[model samples]
Target: MAEKIIKGIVIDRFNFRDFDLIVSLATNFGVIKMVARGVRRPTSKNIYILNPGCLGEFEIFLARYSNKLSKLKKGECFFNLDLNDKKIYAFWKLVSQITRETNFVPKIFPILEQSFAKINSKNADAIKVYTIINWIKFNGWIANLTRCRVCKTNQRLINFNFYGGMECVYHQNPKPFFRFGRKELEIFYWSSSNLNTFLEKVDFDYIYLVFEILKQFLKQNSYIFL
Candidate 1:
């Protein structure tokens, strides 16, 4: 294939051989894996752009007749979050853990980019939760939190099942993954809104709750992760 440029995030990277690296990039097309040859060498300029959560445009190539791994020729970093902060680091780590080519979607790329761009010291916690929720929603795994899955009533959706379904107290899963009280339910309610509004309305105290809930939600939905 001719050389092409793709704008995306470096979701995961690992040393391949002596001086090469393998990276997974989440792009509009899909989750693409490419080998960056000799990027680990002292003379290489592309090494730093392989960091997880680095947003950049990569020049890539593949030969039509070959079945070998695709090649990443060079990269130009747009920006990368400061990975030293614990929350920011955790957010990118979670992103790498869940994202995969088999589960790829077009909207995933922009959502990841937007979340990385918008996150900062002030709103790191909420932004991480917001991005995961958005990812879950876009992947069509999020349940209708507004109504009970079985009873079809909106009231008292106090239980969340592992399969991503909601149920009221009147109808509950035999082994529900999470049982939400009024407060937890409230947190989940606003989590569906746009990121900015969610950050504005939800107290910092509740952001951790949302993050825990989303974490468990994904834990149960293991197939969604890589």
Candidate 2:
């Protein structure tokens, strides 16, 4: 097969015997793993561009099968997020780990770029919550929170059913559900529509609530969490 030039974000890396390493990157094609021979050596030129969370153009010798690792011929960095910021660094790492390996997710790149930009702007909490919600939304796990899934009523939704989706007080059933207070529902609705605005004014409690809900949902459905 012909060599392909692709741009991607280096999300994770694993050291191999001696001076080699395996690097995983997120590209338009999906998550790709490539072998970087001798990159662990002190004098290796590829080390700089292979840093985790670095976005760059790369020359990849594509593998015949998606599960097999490809050969990385060369790479040039566009940008590398400062890994010194422990919070943001950890957040991106988790995002990379939770994302599916071989599947295509069209919205992943924009959401990741926006997330990095938001962290660079120092809006850490807001952007973290916003990014997670968008991830869930793009993955098709988010149900319409504004109306009841069954009755299609505009009444307040207070119960969350993994099997049946969001529900109202009058539509309760035997399925297990997560109950939310009125205040939490209001915040959920507001945040979904006006995430940027909510970020500007969100308090710690609001951020905590949003994360709790999202974490549980993700863990239940995708078996991944922050």
The per-prediction CA RMSD against the true structure, in angstroms, equals 3.9, 4.0
Tens digits of per-residue lDDT, candidate 1, 1-226, equal 6788899888888899899998888888777778999999999877888888789998999545434677898898988988898877777676766566655667767667777768887788777776776677677766665677777787867776535556788988876566666655655566666666777777777678767777766777755431
Q: lDDT tens string, model 2, 148-215?
A: 76897867677655443567888865555466666555555554554456556445466667677777
Q: Which stretches of candidate 1 lie over 4 Å from their true place?
A: 15-19, 62-67, 101-106, 145-183, 223-226
Please report the candidate that would top TM-score against the real structure.
1
By summed lDDT, which 10 consecutive residues of candidate 2 come out lowest?
A: 186-195
Q: Against the true structure, candidate 2 has what lDDT? A: 0.71
TM-score, predicted candidate 2 vs. hidden true structure: 0.71
Q: Please report, in order, the local distance difference test score of every candidate based on alpha carbons.
A: 0.74, 0.71
Give per-candidate clash totals.
Answer: 1, 0
Q: Tell me each candidate's TM-score.
A: 0.73, 0.71
